[model samples]
Target: MRKEIHLEHSSLKYPLPEQFVQELSEELAFMNEYPSGGSYKTLSAKLAEYTDIAPDCILPANGSDEVIESITRAFGNRLILIPIPTFSQYEVSAERNGLNKKFVPCLEGHNYRLVYCEEDLKKASLIWICNPNNPTGSSIPREEIKRVLDIAPGIVAVDECNYEYLGESVVDLIEQYPNLAISRSFSKNFGLAGLRLGFAVSSSKNIVEIARYGQHFRVNKMAERAGIKVLKYLDYFQNIWQEIARTRDFFIAGLKGLNIMVLPSKTNFVLVDFTTEEKARKIWNFLRGEKVFTVAGWEQEFSGLDNQYLRFTISNQEEMSFVLELLKRFPENTS
Candidate 1:
């Protein structure tokens, strides 16, 4: 049997620099000490310098996963409205916290673009929207996001884990709308997924309340040191983001040439539709045999349309080319 490609993986396929590794090694001496109670203070100061928000507005967590959990905990038992086919964690978090979930399914014929009408916004106590949405890799327009924020007075969590690729963010909107909270992850563009560090940017009042739910030393000491080092090489990070975007466009164009229908993506991944579920499964197995992995389509209550779609991440030029070549020779196994 061929080894299966782990489609659930969602991080950049790059290694951290030797310098970053060295810095992490130096921090090993402090590993025995507990992380600062307010883990976000120094990290937040650096982020605030970059985002122009006060350090107090930033709340660091073990990962954005924990940040989502903290928010759900803070707003317990409220009706949560999520636009369907998004990050599964939103639903998982809601269920774990005993919050009721109401989903607004994205229109199938319309490539799953967010259809957040005023009525949908009115129904949610909290709304989680992924800009450059996951699995599908489509981005909601900035104006549309603002409209949702305006219509929905409830907490709106914008997960911008893939924000570096898109170069658009609503971080500035946090000051104007108390209900808005933006989640940023060092995992994606920064290549720190294993480190599991991320932070939420929101108003100071909201941060204070959310911080109450978060543990004093939620983030590990090593991850904090890694984050601080990454900040120092911010320019290098930007260059990598640009390279990923370039490679993404190149790969999408190649997919189009092969008649593989791919949605326009603002993130590092592309969503391609296969002719049938069996064909998709065959391609997935073939890729796995070659050590290439991508995300499989959601196959549950939301499986009415395009159960054959697959999500592929953009990597370095050489690896991306190899994957594309392998895709070009993909066997026609519709059975």
Candidate 2:
């Protein structure tokens, strides 16, 4: 059987710290018990310590997906503004709650930077910003986010699930701006995607409201224990994050050497622009035949450009080198 390489979902290629195995083993006996409800006090406290925020300001969920949904339901009664060619969940949550949504197109010529007009800012009650955005892997500037918060009448929820890769955050502004809520996940940096641990950080009041739409005991025990244990090993994951960054840069250089147009990324993935759908499909199909799977841009609802793009997750140097070699030998379309 051929070994398959999956670059579709952006989960980290590294494994969690070895200590987690013992942690989960200890949690196994408690599988019969239900998790604590009402925002999961202990888990929230651990997350609070990790994020350097008040315990009351943390709301643990199944994952960032649930966090986004809760934030959308809690504050998305009015119009919600989402920048396009970004994460699809922002749109999914808005539509699921039956709230009105506006898709703001990010500037394609400008590294896909997010731009919001004063009119849209004032009209929106909820604005979703995916920092180091998914698929595009582009980061929104701190000043830009602050500018939006200054004028936007409602919540500005920034998804920082990939923040560890870039080491940038606006979490400190949560105290200054009551409307700011940041969603983070343990999936990418912590290598705990299977455990499904994520949380929302904001003002204590905002957290209380976000908690309302959530069901009781949404976070399971294994995930709770894992979240606490992982906080102790930030140094371990920080090393891995640095390694991924290095690997990402190497991969980007290799792609560029192939004369491919690759987008700049702060996240753990790179977006490749093939300039046209035909070429993109050809490359994607070729890679798939080689047991290497990548994500196509249109599949993620990437808008504002006809150029077909593909996103590849960064792994170690050997795997990336393998990919580059595959691209080097990509079978030509003779048709």
- lDDT top scorer: 2
lDDT of 2 at 241: 90
Tens digits of per-residue lDDT for model 2, 1-335: 96899988888898777777777798899989888878787888888887888899899999999999999999999899988787888888888889999989885653776688999999999998889887788888999999999999899999999989878999899889998999999998888898898899999999889988888887888888888788888888888898899999999998888888888989899888887798999899899999999888657545433447888999888888999999888755212
Which candidate's TM-score is highest?
2
What is the TM-score of candidate 1? 0.92
Worst 10 residues of 2 by lDDT: 298-307
lDDT of each: 0.79, 0.86
lDDT of 1 by residue, 1-335 (tens): 54433334668766677787888898998888877768457877887887778888898888888888888777545678777777777788888877898877884743766687787688777888888787677888888888888998788989887888888899989889999988888888888898899888888888887788888888888888777778877777888888888998999898887777788888888777886787888888788778887777754322223568777878778777787788888856312
What lDDT is reached at residue 74 by model 1? 75
Weakest lDDT window of 10 consecutive positions for candidate 1: 298-307
The positional error of residue 151 in candidate 1, measured at the CA in angstroms, is: 1.2
